[model samples]
Target chain A: MPPLPVITGLGFITSIGQDRATVGRSLRELQHGFERVEFFGNPNLPVKVAGTIKGFDFPTPSWRDWRWPDRFTVDRELLRGLAPHGVYALCALQQALTEAGLEPGELGDGTTGLFCASAGSPFMLGSFLGQMRETRGERGNPMGVVSSIAGTLNFNLATHYRITGAVCGFVSACASSSHALGYAMDEIRLGRQQRMLVVGAEDMTDESIMAFSSLRALSNNPDPATASRPFDRRRDGFVGTGGAVALIVEDAALARRRGAHIIAELIGWGQAGDGHSVTASHPEGAGLREAMRRSLADARVNARDVGYVNAHATSTVAGDRSEALALHATFTSQGARPRVSSTKALTGHGLSLAGVMEAAFCALAIDEGFIPGAAHLEEPDPVCTGLDLPRTSLAEAPGLVLNNSSGFGGSNVCHLLRRPA
Target chain B: MKTSAPSPTASTEHEQSIRHLPAPARAAFEQFQAGGDPATLDPVVLAILADFSPRASEIPLADLPGDTMLIDDLGFDSLAITEVVFAAEDLFRINITNEEIVQVRTLDHLRGFIRAKVAGRSAR
Candidate 1:
C-alpha cells in the first residue's frame, strides 16, 4: 500500500497572525482579529467592518536575493508587477520552503508540483480600471493584464521558485483553496508527484467588498468582536479579509527520510458540487454532507474515531443553518458526534484562504493538543444545535480532525487530517 | 511640402538624431517637436519608444521607421501592442482604448494619434 501523504511544512498569514506559531497561539486564546475595514471602507458600502491583518510588513528583494547587477533589470520588472496576493503567496512560499529545508534547486525536482487557489486580483483590477479612467483609455500598464489574472499568484510562485512541475490554480470561489489542497494530496497519494505545495492567498479590495455588500453578504455590525458571529442567532454575514496559507505535502516516507517535521497526516480529501444553485447553497447542505462522508470513508476511519471538526461557517443566517443541518445529519447517521467549531469567527472567513488556513489551524491543533472555540458564538441558533459548539478553547488532543469548506456555486470540500504518531 | 527644421526648444540627443533622418520621418519628428505639448514632446515619444523597443525586439527604437507597420515591421502581437499602448499612456498621460489601438497600424499613425489627442486635451 502507498504511504499516506503528510503535511511536512506549514506557513500562513491571516488577519489573526502571520505565522503558524503565532496563529496557533491566537487560536488557542480565542483571539479575534475582526476590526473596522481600513482599506476597503466606503460610506455607501453596506458593511463597515472586516477582518484585516494590521501592520503587515512585506519583504523587499536585496542585492543578493535578486542576483543584482546581472539580472537587476528583469528582476525589477517582475517585482514591479507583483500584486498583493502574489506577494503574500511568495512570502508564505518562502517560509514553507525554508521550513521544509528545500532550496530553489530542490523545488525544481520533477516530482514536485504546485497547486494554488485564488478567487481574483481585485487590487490589480482596481488599479487597471483606475489607470483606464485617469488616462481616458489612452494607455495603461503592460503588466496589468498579467497582474489581474486569477492564476497570477500560482504562476509567479512556480516561476519564482524554479519549479517546473505541474502548476495549477483552482477558482471555486471560497472553496478554491480547499480544492487546491485536496487535489494536491491526490497528486501525491496517486504517485503523480512526490511532493506538492498548496497555497491560498487573497486580498480584500474595495471592489470585492463593495460587490459583497451589494449582495448583502457582509456584516454591518460596528463591533469588531461581534461582527462575525458564526452559529449565533443574530449572525448577519461574513467579514471580508486578506489572508494566505501555504503547506508542503510530501510522501510520508520521503518526509521521514528528510527528518522533516510532520505537522499532520493528510488522510483523506473529498470535493462535491451542489448542482442546485448558482449562488445559494442547497437548503439541506447535501453537497457538504456528501463531501464529509466521502472524506471520512477515504480515510478508512470511522466517524466515531473523528474527534474534532473545523467548520466553514461564514456567519451568515442561511449559510450557518445549512452547514449545521449538514453536520448534524452526517454525524448522527454515523451514531457519533464530534466537537465542531468555526475558526472563521476569528479569521473572518478569508474567502480563498478560508480552507487552507483552517487546515493550517487543524495541523497546529494536532501539534498543540488544543482545539479553538468558535469565538463570538454566544447565542447559538436553535437550528445550529445538537453539535458540541464549544464557547471556549478545549484542551484535548484529537486523533482525527475534519475541516469542511464550502463556497459559492455550491462547491464543498472536506479534508481529513490525522495526528502525527 | 515645407519641412520645418528641428525646434530650438528641444535640444535632446533624440532631436539631434531625428534631424539626420530621411525627409518624411524627420518631418514628422519636427512636427511633433514644434507642437510644444509635453505629451507630444520628443523626449516623451523617445521614452515610450525606448520602453517599447525591448518588447518589439526585432529592431531598435533608433532605427524604427515612422511608417513601419506595428505587426508587420515591428512584430507586435496584440498583447505586445497592448503593453506598448500602456507604456505610451503612462509616458504621455493619455488613454488609448482597444478600438483606438486597432486604428493604429504604423508608427506614423501612432504619432498622429498622440498629436490629435494632445490637441483635443489642449482645446478642452
Candidate 2:
C-alpha cells in the first residue's frame, strides 16, 4: 500500500496570529483579532469590523515600497507582478517551506506540486480597471490582469517558487481552498506528486469586503465580540477576514524519512454541488450532507469514531440552519454527536480563505490537543439543537476531525483528518 | 539615402537587431537633432524608465548613456517597455501605440517619441 498523505508543516499569516505559537495561544485563550476600518473611506459599508491583519506595512500600492516584517526577507523584484493576496501567499509559503525543512531546490522538484486559492485581489482589480477607465483604456498595466484575476496566486507562486510540477488554482467562492486542499491530497495519495503545497488568501479592502454587502451576507453587528456568533439565534450574517495560510502535504513515508514533523493525516475528502440555487444553499443542506457522508466513506471510518467537526456555519440564518440540518441528518440519526464549532466565530469568515485556514486549524487541534469551540455561540438556533456545539475550547485531544466548507453556487467540500499515529 | 557614410551597413536595420536601435528610430533621432532646436524633454521619462531597467542596481540610472540600448544595454523586455510607456502616459497625459514604440531601441529614441507626442498634445 502507498504511504498515506499527511500534513508536515503549517504557516499562517492570519488576523488571529502570524505563527503557530501565537495562533495556538489565541485558540487556547479564546481571543479574537477584530478591528474597525474605513471601507474605502466610506463610513457606511454595512459591517464596521473584521478579523484584520496589522503587520507588513505598505505605504503605497507599489509592492516595492512595502516594509516587510523582520521574519520575512523578500526579493522585492519578484513581487512586481503579484497582487496583495499573492504577496501574502508567498510569505506564507516561505514560512511553510522553512518549517518543512525544504530548500528552494528541493521545492523545485518536478514531483512536487502547488495547489492554491484566492478570490483574486479585488482591490488590485478595482484599482487597475479604474485606472484604465480613467485613461480611456489607452494604456494598460503590464501586470494588471496577472495580479488581479482569480489565478493570481497560481501565476505568482508557481513562478516565484520555481514550482516545476503541477500547479493549479481553485475558485468555488468560499470553498475554493478546501477544494485545493482535497485535490492536493489526492495528487499525493495517487503518487502523482511527492509533495503538494496547499495555500490560500484574500484581500481585506473595501473593494473585496463590500462586494458581499449587496448580497446582504455581512454582519451589521457593531460589536466585534458578538458579531460573528455562528450558531447563536441572533446570528445575522458573517463577518469577513483576510490573511494567508499554507499547509505542506506529502507522503507520510516521505515525511518520516526526512524527519519532518507530521501534523495530521489527511484521511479523505469529498466535494458536491447542490444544483439548487446560485446563492442560497439547499434548504436541507442536502449537498453538504452528501459531502460529509462521502468523506466518511472515503476514509473508511465509521461516523461514530469522528471526534470533532469544524462546522461551516458562517452566522447566516439560512446558511447556519442548513449546515445544522446537514449535521443532524449526517450524525444525529446515527446516534453520533461529535463536538462541533466554527472558528469563524473568532476569525470571521475568510471567504475563499476559510477552507485551507480551517483545515490548518484542525491540524493545530490535533497537534496541540485542543478543539477550538464556537467563540461567540450563544442562544443556539433551534436547528442546532441536536448537533453538539461546544461554546468553549476543550482541553482534550480531538482524535479525528472533519472540517466542512460551503460556498456560493451550492458548492460543498469536506475534509477528514486524523491525528498522526 | 544610400550613400555610405563609412558605416552604412547593408540589409534592413529593422530585420537585423532586436537589441540595437532599428533604422527608423535612428533616422528619427538624426532628423530631430538636425533641426537645431533640439527638444528639451522632461526628466520624468528618464526617471520612469530607469526604474524599469533591470541593470539599474549595477550600472545605476544616472550613468546610463543617452544612446544606450534599452533592450541590450539597459535590459528591458517588451513588457518592461510597455510599463515604461504606461508611466509616461500617466505623466505626460498622452497616448502611445504599441506599433509606434515597439521599435524604439534607445533612451534618445524614447525621448524623441515622447517629445513628438507631448508636442502633439500641446498642439491639440
Q: Over the stretch B9-58, how does candidate 1's per-residue lDDT look in tens digits?
A: 33464554344234554555456647656343544554455444424254
- Candidate 2 ranges with C-alpha deviation above 4 Å: A56-61, A64-68, B1-43, B53-59, B64-75, B90-124
Candidate 1, A243-313: lDDT as tens digits: 67899999999999999888899999888888898878889999999999899889888788889999999
Docking class of 1: incorrect
Q: What TM-score results for chain B when candidate 1 is compared with the true chain B?
A: 0.57
Task: Tell me how much of the true interface, by contacts, candidate 2 captures.
Answer: 0.33
User: What is the Cα-based lDDT of residue A147 in candidate 2?
Assistant: 81
Q: iRMS values in order, in angstroms? A: 10.8, 12.1
TM-score of 2: 0.87
TM-score of each: 0.77, 0.87
Question: What is the per-residue lDDT of model 2 for residues A251-290, given as tens digits with 9 covering 90 to 100?
Answer: 9999999999999999999988998999999999999999
